[model samples]
Target: MSKALRRTFVAATSLLALLAGASPALPTQGTFLAPIAEHHHDSSLMYGTSSNWSGYAATGGKFTSVSAEWVQPTVTCTKTDTWSAFWIGLDGDGSRTVEQIGTEADCSGGTPVYGSWYEMYPAYPAYFNNAVHPGDHFTASVTTTGNGVFNLTLRNVTRNWSRSIAKSLKSATLASAEVIAEAPSSSTGVLPLADFGTVGFTNAKVNGKSLGASNPSVIDMATKDGVTKATTSGITDGTAFSVTWKHS
Candidate 1:
């Protein structure tokens, strides 16, 4: 994370992005919107090759549940606007639907902002009124409660706050499970990524099995041409991993 290396990574990522016909990065602000597409443009940073995803994913199983724990990162708004989200979700690897819930840390007007929300793909995500801030401990889970019905839950261990929502998606394929730190999408495209320093996830599991037991893919945020967007640490002790900010 040195100044020279960071600058190199950013320049290379930006060049590759321009070559890929991507739009120039926008100045992101306000609350995250429910994505209009089933997949976000930032899926390039994901690790798996199952169509769409940039996070660790387990395929070939009827993934019943996925969970992970992370302490909020201290985000800094060195620039005017940027965005990032941390969440656990099911589907969206080989399916059109994604069931997800987590928190967002956004840099708006050079100020760090935080909040929590949930999304059932193809529908708009809803933000919860519960407070979220840097250093809060969070545990989030997405469960497939049979027949494409899902139960999503998120808890703030430091605040004794939690929220759960149950919804049904009859067409869900249950193809994959994911734990992700993302540059969330909006109507325009992928938003400018926030500088979240580094965030670590522990006790990551799918269907009650650790990530190693599930044999999921390890993902680093990069484009097809090999320019780094973010760097992900290899899975350690089956359950822990980290994603460090590289470039927006």
Candidate 2:
């Protein structure tokens, strides 16, 4: 075989081998790098708002991958020491674990701090060495390469920095996939949410298809009582979408 064909054969065989193996043991806690341990507030509402999350989720099937492209929003911290994250991932919808990667646009001491990160939920998030700035175009993804194994990739297209991680988690069910903007959780509770103005996610896809083709669930973030935090624009051209922040 030619070199390229040989490599393809080896990769295909490896994937098949992995899928045929027994599932790995679940981790003690979800693995997402963050300042403190906090619950991820999620949503399934198609059109509305919430205090926690605003994005698209594809449910009702065993999803293998999720990805999105977005230009990082310029954040103005109306309040100090606030937090928010924009990310794409698999699981964490109806499952106990999440494999997610995204960026943070936060306020520290009333100043804006921008950075990138990846998490396997319940675990604190880990930051990337690459510098992040407002208006940087980013592309991120989470893929389940096989049973209990995942790959997370994040790229700062504007800055030309990228990171990829692969690991195994037996607890992951690959039940759902998402692209979201959130008020990060903390040990005390959900942290103070930052005022991130507006965030737009474009070219969203699931299992290598446009979001619309996957029949995704539209979610609007809100408080526990259903007070809207942010509103999502309907998917355009089957792939592009936007989220407008309302209250912090």
Candidate 2, lDDT over the whole model:
0.68
The true-versus-predicted C-alpha distance at residue 68 of model 1, in Å, is 0.8
**Tens digit per residue, CA lDDT, model 1, 1-248:** 12111111111010001111111222223444442223322322323321112357666678889999999898888756787878888876556677888887778788777777787776667777677779999999998766878999999999999999999988787777888777765544556678899999999999998977886766556644555566677788989998888777
lDDT tens readout by residue for model 2, 1-248: 02211000000000000011111221112122252211232333333333456777777778899999999998776545777789998876666677888987777666776767777765545666577788999999889865888899999888888999987888887887788887775444455667788888988999999988877666666666556677777899999988877766
* Root-mean-square deviation per candidate: 8.9, 13.6
- Assess each prediction's global lDDT (C-alpha) against the native: 0.69, 0.68
Give candidate 1's error at residue 197 in angstroms: 0.7
Model 2 TM-score (2 dp):
0.79
